[model samples]
Target: NVYYADFDKILLEVCVGKNRLKTERTDIYTNIRHFGRTTKKGYSFKAVIPVDKINGRDKIYFEYTYGEAKVRTSITFLSFQSRLSNKLPESYWIFGNSILSYDEKKKQMIVEPLTFGSHLKHEIKMMYRVARHGRKRIGKKKTLEMLRLRASIKLNRGFGRKDNDSISGAPKNKKPVWITYDQLFKGGDNGQYFYEYMNKNVSDIETCYIINKDTKEYKELTRKYDRKTVLPFSTYKTRLKCLKSDMLFATRIDIRLYMGFTENDEIYVRDLFKADVVCLQHGLTIQKIAQYQNKFYDNTKHYFCVSPKEVENITKPIYGYTNDMITLTGAPRYDGLVGEPKKQILITPTWRRNVTAGTNEKGKQHEYSVNFKRTTYYQIYNSLINDKRLIAAAKKTGYRIVYLVHPILSPQADDFDKNDFVDIVPGVKANYEKMLKESALMVTDYSGIQFDFAYMRRPLVYFHPAELPPQYAEEDTGFGPICRTNDELIDELIKAMQSDCRLEDSYKDNINNFFPYDDQSACKRVYEAALKITNFS
Candidate 1:
């Protein structure tokens, strides 16, 4: 007998020598019953063969097929117990050279095939389970174990250091310290802008920033402030400051950014840390993200939002946040968006999971598929940028086109063909605020950056080459004209250029309804909300 498992179905084959046998006996027991039809295609089939006909020369194959579209899949077996009427085998077994383990929660045997690299095999298998069953079903213990495993993986990837240090170096009798950062290795987002605002307007609280000392952003920051204000990331001193701080602010709530890189470091920060966490989001909430659910942010004290609609989205049953937990304070980076407009068109598209090869524990894509140039995302943008009509129109209208690749897709920046009419910029080096202020028109596909351009009363064109996830499929994105083809996007670009990128009144009304504040006081509001949350006002 041979067994095989695929993404949608399972197959079992019984053979005698070179001949195959078929039977109508469909009753077979496996641990899959514990899931109770978790998959869409839950039905199974089997064939029975006489045991006397089987021989040692006959071969049986037990295989698991993984699809490129699906990141993870698994097969499991179970040992016989009184709970199952003692009809099954007493010992667990696997036929292939795969990682085998026991799932105590479901009382089943788990097997993970070594089809990919072995850098973080166990951790990757755990991620597959979390994706399949979700965090709530997996319980808190498994989730914490996953975090710890992820932390060790990240340390090997140079995201942090493995150092032991004390908090004795921290300031002893200074004011309450508040640490802020956008990314562990980068800056220039809501976190940086809010930290700047805190330093300029308020003096009661001490502000510090954590950034990678090896980055260009760090060199730029050091020229403005002393070392105490700009602490190096993943170092003992930074960890000390984080431990001594009273409050922590960030655009992302990742534990790796605030805690040391080790197995138990994330558990310590999440369960034992005393500092209050305030999430200054990098972008407005425009889609349903599974990671943003309530259980993932158990330590977050305040969640700053951009509008009432965003607040409503967070308070939904899926997100599980209460009204009191949210604050309707606009993004801090919006306060610094002040500059003259130029006749330039910015085309920025978000990354897709299907096209990316894999991401690190911090949700940063460090690799891209070898066939990335063959993906639809690449073909569409590549064709649009190189279109003869679009290139001629930009040249004739005295307009420049800039393509900004999302940071996660930066490794493939060279995949697209370059021409004189268009300039390609990597997201890591892009001056986001500068581009937002200078660009007169913006073209995007499901990027939250569209709101930033809309805040400037500029025109926007959306390109939809693929269907969005189910959560965002029903979202009403009527703030701009959505284009479905390369020709349609080119036509919209020419039309916007003809009118000097003036936003339509209907879209203007949409933008107005989306954002309640544009008075450059969002940083102040966010600061006040943080002070209130920490009871430091």
Candidate 2:
């Protein structure tokens, strides 16, 4: 049902059309019903417009007629084939490093929310959308139509097989190298750093990054670098490049999940030609609290080593990988870590699994509220942020704290009170890295960024409330003072500032143990490795 504001007397009629052809098509729709009443602000109604089929058109148009005024809108239809097609853009949230695991009991993927706010927001929205859909005509038929559409499309595509028969051919550029990050493309990660290094330093190797189309990152990349250096992720050109490329560098193999391609698709393509793959990991793997397993490590030829411990852990007997697959080339993302330290604190916390809220089955809007303030995270952080002791300590130390909320909590920035004492900074992924570079100290609870800060030889303080969710145990953090209460955190901060923010002796030892190289030659090492990997082909 459509709503009109402050309606007096208006004769309105709604009609459906196929493309530009307008008519009251009886075959396309059936049992049209309307239910609503007039309110002070407007006249609202629910018109149950159920369409049996789209009849092969890309979209159906709706015409709203009201007294010499005609408004138009169109609803696009997706056959199941189109749903899994490479034409659609992937969802943005998955790249935030949230884990999705298949639950056998529930028969659905368990999604953990990124922050307290997202957890609450999802819960609220799920309920609201479920109830709203019950009262709408579009609600009931939508799920059935979607399933039917999917089935119809799958039948046409020969079901669960590659549609790349048209793409089969010999290599276009035999020596081409391909690069990409996870589906969610961000800035200044290992992927971009590697691409930049290859373009400026390495020679005689054609390189291109797999980028999503119509994305701001894509536009920015094209504006900053050569437009021809990027290939659209889901297009024929990308598949051709992947098939023919001699070497592949990527942050993750999760692109398959995003593109609706299976492991078998990759295997089928791999059978044609062996493309040596190098994995430049996006972040340091914290095994204890890591939600997702390294499922793709076995598939790759080389894995970039961020630390000695990472290499050791991944090559354990259970992981089934040997040292032969490990390359001690440090992550390219860490090559340019130069910055003058400022009196600032960066707070980056890990996400939680228990706090995740699932959406309704029919995919309707949900409206509900979770007491975000009462959450364990809020209870601990809010106390420290608003505490007079911390404020006084901050003033004495001449330092300001910036709460770099996780990307998942992006929408819930308002959940915290904005004031001079604490700044809740949440914006672009690129800016987050920039902030890290400028910070003198980092306060976090089990985030991989700890490794990055430690690499800079800066002081770090870990504040974990006992009541909050369990991250990795305290022992897992080899260096850094662990503070459970606000008072402890304040005392630690003041002491660290008085010492001129030098990283402790233990931290130095840990840094040395983790990173074998601190000479800023990571990109060089990576390029040399790439040359060795491609020499055979």
Candidate 3:
């Protein structure tokens, strides 16, 4: 029997001595109740072989008939008697570039990946479409009690188990530290700086970077740091390193890194390894962000706080951080923001949670509504950038509008007008320090980059299209000139640019009270803290 990825048109053909004989459809497979339905989850087709009637010269074929195109591949059938005759190894029956295995617990045949998309490169990546196409919730409905039972069963799987040395092959060192960026992609903020500090500056410690296999940094880091260890994301080896290392550092709270597999996985790892988790925060805290709510777990021992007010107002009270766990190290990303300003006005706005709230026919989640132009937030922000008043103001003032969009809306940036006066900066390609330094004024709304601009003594104009969300409204955003209407935003931009973008007195006060470090020693302090082991348990 063979299993392929999900497709509507699949047939199994049996050939005896080069003569066309019989064809089988997988939908009729009912030896197992879930066989017909498993194809929706990327496992398609099953072939029942009549091996007794076939000779050594006979062949079996699988055909995928899609639209007008037919893709056919054949494999020579060795024999079915290998299991009964005991003359051949388990590798006798291999098909379609995949290993066939049976799941004893599920009572079904299991193909390792169940998909061929994993083998393709980036240019021809079709795995995402195949897995997500025609996806719908399946299986029998269950009551709340049944769901609870399943959860309890999963929680109790490896509870209180003895330490397993499955991942104990990590290098022998006095201090082993693991560092990673958000989602294990690449470093941009404090995570980047600290990873570099330990990877290059510190010689006594062993540094390992956790990276997603698809990330560009994965190959680069692996090639550069040949002497040190580099763990690929979502592997047992990486999980073991997280569990055994003296400390773990990352940009955000990733619960999957600790207890994703089982509830006791975190307990076993934290207790056995005494691994302290440090959060080198991605940005400054101003609003009541959802990601920061009750983020501290048992193993989360230290948080790199940027300011005292952030700890006093947001981090300590709302985010559940104690004074001992808070380390007031100004963000290392800001160390590069100290430079001259160019005649460029940057327009950056926060993302609306509701804009990306619709679903497609296949029940797959997608952001950006078809009626996005109707939303007040979209209309106001979009109109402002393309507004003749703002563009003309920039042209007359001898300034260019360098629009640095949020990474979420980056792909759609070109959807707006592209004039010589307005340049759309790609978020990934742009050098953050140089862009920030070149911009004389920042036009924003509740984005942390506003703070970055204010900290650098550049003028900022807050443009609020409608009544701000209560979570963001409640927080103080310093003393930048705010614009509630389109006209007001335009007036403020022209006024700031005309006056050469001077910093307001109240903004200076906010800056003085916000960041603790002014000597550019943030990286040094964060690197020093990375070496110490804090046992939160």
Candidate 4:
């Protein structure tokens, strides 16, 4: 509703993986073709392909094109970039759609979205090309279906709905959902806190608390993926248990605010069967790249689109769901960071190696050469773990040092030692609310940490290690300085930590536009939407 924005037309540019066509007719058109599975009439959103000619080879495309005859795409690469700005809400900007491209007729090349990667250009182009027909139809909706199919497989493999006798033993409460995270260890792994918090936060509402499933012994979160433990990965058996669960509490409607997650995780599919299922993903650029992997749920009840900004112009094209589907509820994990963002500083470097694609038993796949600048948990940890300067400040200034390790590096305590100066807190399953409540400041690079920190409106010092390859930058982007060495880390961390009330002065304007957590009613907005969708009262 702003005057200037109303007149500001979205800028449409066309650029791509080596313009295969003549420089002339490369105009990026808003007109687009929908890529539906089966007979192909199904197209979620449209996009203006900014390219010469979508060759049959390349996997992705970007920028803009030239010409009137230039494929007038509705929600193509051009439109998404034109409307969305950086720093959109993490939950709103979801990376979706994994199929290469639907032949608009043949029906084939159905694949899952690449939930954990940073090759947007590569994903987009390949998705468009491989989807040329009769190959394997992978649409956003299909990815979701794939999840259900996985669960169905689980049913066949044994993990089915709780037996009638088991249901009869229910604790007077028909709570139909079950969740288990290996990370939470508050009450000596007994999961006593579940009852405590459930009672306090959601008590006497006919609920059952049973976490730390294997707490009879000491099994730390991330100890090792055990099917016998809590919830395992999206395996065949896991799916069945998830599917047969009562639809009312099928899943938590996981609205991931940060980046990186399986497009077809069991939880996502479980939500599909439930009446009130919804997913909150972030990023226009991220979502489009992930398009190929998630085309399955292109037209499902549970599937929805919710990114940081709603990026208005582009999101409207693909996400047909109402604004309710797009709750601006920042993120439950980030709820504590709003308004009271810290003035002090804490360092949280990015963690890589653990999440490598080809990383197998032998070790992380070291062959593939990435195209961006990236730093790993091992590298960053070693570089600054014993840094004399960092230690001195933590001890002297009481800088409140906490290392927020990515999920991959979390369980492996054998790799690094956590001393008095450093506390290794895994980003996964680790309650971010606790981190935000205790700390006054945070420092992180890439990895969805920025989005979580931004909600707090705290001063974040981005440490850009020069040792990392430039291609890593494609992994993530947020405003701040780049620290290349231990010395730079000290200076930045010191300044950020020492400052008492400089956050509002230094990061005020940017935080306002980026996070905008000024109001605490985001949860209310999200809750109401969920109520209307499921009529849950």
Candidate 5:
């Protein structure tokens, strides 16, 4: 169970091949081989799964093994080629742009992307007129229906349908991929509210994080990165190109995402809204608004803000905003805070804002580096490296730090090379459970993790570094224990380390409209939300 995720979100592999030489075909499974683990006589070939699997300390045990007289997992790199090509259909891609048809006789389906854009791309009247007067060449309604249905299937885990049976025959090992936006530490009322909203609205007790692509990895120049992350699959143009190529060996695509970002500007979202339901984790951040410059959103509808209590004190009522709409649903994560917390302290630092670990020297910035601007990361890093009192206090008090870097930061830094001070990590969803299980001491600067950390009723410490950017003008600093110095901060931290200030009459009853489920039903909440979105069926 890996808590901190790296650039590769997941690494999963499946093994598929016939038992006899008569079934000698080799390109049986998808994904390129990474490494071969074991071998038994000559009965089987052990192929490394293609996706990254995150369990670090505990290796995943398949629990059971299939027919095996021998295993052949070892392979030479000089020539590592998977030849499961002949039996499968080429190009399993079914996207916004693809020509498709089902061949009932052969029980095969063919998809050709780029030959035609999506039927929805045309005006409704033009599309209808084209459909009525001319030959149906292939689709408009049928293709869109299937694509939407595929997304729905992935969302509800196929809701009682036999996903294994395709127009073509069932392949051996096939699993659908489910992905969603991560909102644990996005901060502001939106992030907190959405965190709780997801916990209460979504189901399946799952958590997945996707790192930005700009963060790259390099094997050359010691500290240098090549264009590998961007070269093969970077932009949408490149992604489409790669898809056209991935088509050669693909069997079928279970589901593809427009991904976690729920921008109304997206062609897919705009098309789906009339007939589809959507659940979002965070409302628009200030950066997003500035980036869009009033052009990114449509005035017709607004994003539903689920975590309102987190921002109610500072933000005005957002439920009825005009240009950009927001619904105040109250987050599901904070439901536990309804009465009072046994103890609570949240220490989370903001991610790099203007500067990063490695960057070109043109004074250019990623712009998304919010934390980098408010607090100097390298300085805090130095403080953590040199401070003995802080370290000793953490150790003596049986304190455990819940370090959550920006999800976008991992791609820029290596998990193998991440700071070594972090201690104790339970599985994913259980991170909040970990906070509930252990000490409540939070020490952070400018990071949104502090917002939820406040939801806990324990001591809080804010590390406002000297390097904070002046451009970020805001008067509503969070109300709790705050600090500016090293030694002085430690004493304050020690004082608040074991306190319960969340139950005070001042805030217990005054609730914001944002957060939806403060109780432990976050998973159920999320599952229900997914159901609502998928009811388009």
Candidate 6:
């Protein structure tokens, strides 16, 4: 059974008996045997039933209690060996409302729920299939075929024919159609900077920037560029443009946002769109991420790197990227991280998994609002921001604290305690480039934004109340001194303020070593690399 963590308790009672013969009754405690949480924000549990006590005549009754509600379910016992014997013909199993489709060659079953919406109750179905003969992973061709079938149905219903025609009605040109986006809803990342560079420097190729229509960045961009060049994300026009694109550039590897596809459709849609993908990268590759490996990004033709160390990290056996795939170009956003900073301390922290329920394919925040404040992430940061010592230190140093909540945690922005000296800013609405340039010092907890701050040679303080290990241990990445407590963070801030928020000499050397290019020419290098990949150079 799968349930939210908010449930008071969950228990399973199994009764096995018939009309004439009575058998043993078992009460299984689900918490003792945990299968961990599912990706959809629900805890899964396995009940251990004694199969030896059951007979063919016995009726298996299963009852589970969640919150104040009690639900009774029944299941038939089927031996694993019997199922693998190939005695049963190819069949579709309907467990509750979900339909499980089994693939014989792949030896896997995909469970799809028949009902939709939050009020629908569903059952958990588990099917284990072991391949008798060695078979490769399921091919993407079948998935793409299904996606195209669905898309054709939608098109027949008059969905996107006009938009498709508008995008494909371009004059003949040798250059490829380039599509770039960053976070979909916002701009000012490497993708946006690269798009702007292409529009300014390279005129022969077609370029389109995808952004959310409701965003302030969209309004700003529409005013600056023609409407045809700036396309709203998840729209019919953007989806058609993605299908027609020859080159795709993004900070995130999830390319479904531009095509208005769900998370489940990412693999299929990536295979559907035949384009050379260039990873602009959201941040420096300091921490190890399994998804960034070569197998996951098979369509990626070029991966932008900031320094040799980052290139080395990606080329490692774990990441599995060849040396030729990496383009040694700094992030394009770094070119705009220039300006005289004011006497303000920026507090930016990354999001925690406990605080958010989950995100949709479009990257919208779905928060667990009811228990958001109860999380350790909220309580620790809320207390730290409102701490009198930190507040007084900022006041004494004549520096204001601007607490920028992560975009994923933006839904719970108001949950934090309000203070006089600190101003809470939602990440979605805030201009990150502006904040990065105007801040004197930054206080963060495992955020890649620290690299942006460090690029300006400014002082930074890492608040690690959880005592998380640094991403890079073998060598310094030129990050600030880590503070394990609120008091320690305040002390570090005070010290930084005393020295006029200047970066340490040792850290300066490390920063120079970390970034291969700091000449504000990252856009140029990235543009050249893109041209080379597309054979435009």
How accurate locally is residue 152 in candidate 6, as Cα lDDT from 0 to 100? 44
The lowest-lDDT stretch of 10 consecutive residues in candidate 5 is 246-255
Tens digits of per-residue lDDT for model 5, 137-219 = 22565334324433442243221224342222111112211222222222222223332343344443222222233322111
Residue-level lDDT for 317 in candidate 4: 36
Model 1, residue 163: C-alpha shift (Å): 34
RMSD vs true structure, all candidates: 16.5, 20.5, 19.4, 15.7, 23.5, 15.9
- True-structure lDDT of candidate 4: 0.38
| Residue 347, candidate 6: C-alpha displacement in angstroms | 0.9
Candidate 4 per-residue C-alpha lDDT over 245-323 given as tens digits, one digit per residue, 9 for 90 to 100: 3222111223110011243222222222322224433222232332321322222233222235533422343434344
Instruction: Tell me the tens digit of each residue's lDDT in model 1 across 107-188.
Output: 3344444232432454344445444443564457655554544354334222121132112111222477888887655578
Deviation (Å) of 331 in candidate 2: 1.3
Name the lDDT of candidate 2: 0.54
How big is the positional error of residue 72 in model 3, measured in Å on the Cα after superposition?
63
**lDDT accuracy of residue 188 in candidate 2:** 58
Ranking by lDDT: 1, 6, 2, 3, 4, 5
TM-score of each: 0.67, 0.62, 0.61, 0.48, 0.41, 0.67
lDDT of 3 by residue, 17-118 (tens): 454444533222112225323332222233455545444334334444556666555333221211111111122112323223222333223333213332
- Whole-model Cα lDDT per candidate? 0.64, 0.54, 0.54, 0.38, 0.33, 0.64
TM-score sort, best first: 6, 1, 2, 3, 4, 5
Candidate 6, 321-419: lDDT as tens digits: 578888998888888888999988899988766567755447354654778887888888898889897788788878888999988778889989898
Which residues of candidate 4, in runs, are more than 4 Å off?
Answer: 1-212, 215-276, 281-289, 292-324, 336-345, 353-377, 417-420, 425-431, 469-479, 484-486, 504-506, 519-523
The better-scoring model by TM-score among 1 and 5 is 1
lDDT of 2 by residue, 450-482 (tens): 877787777788877777756444346566878
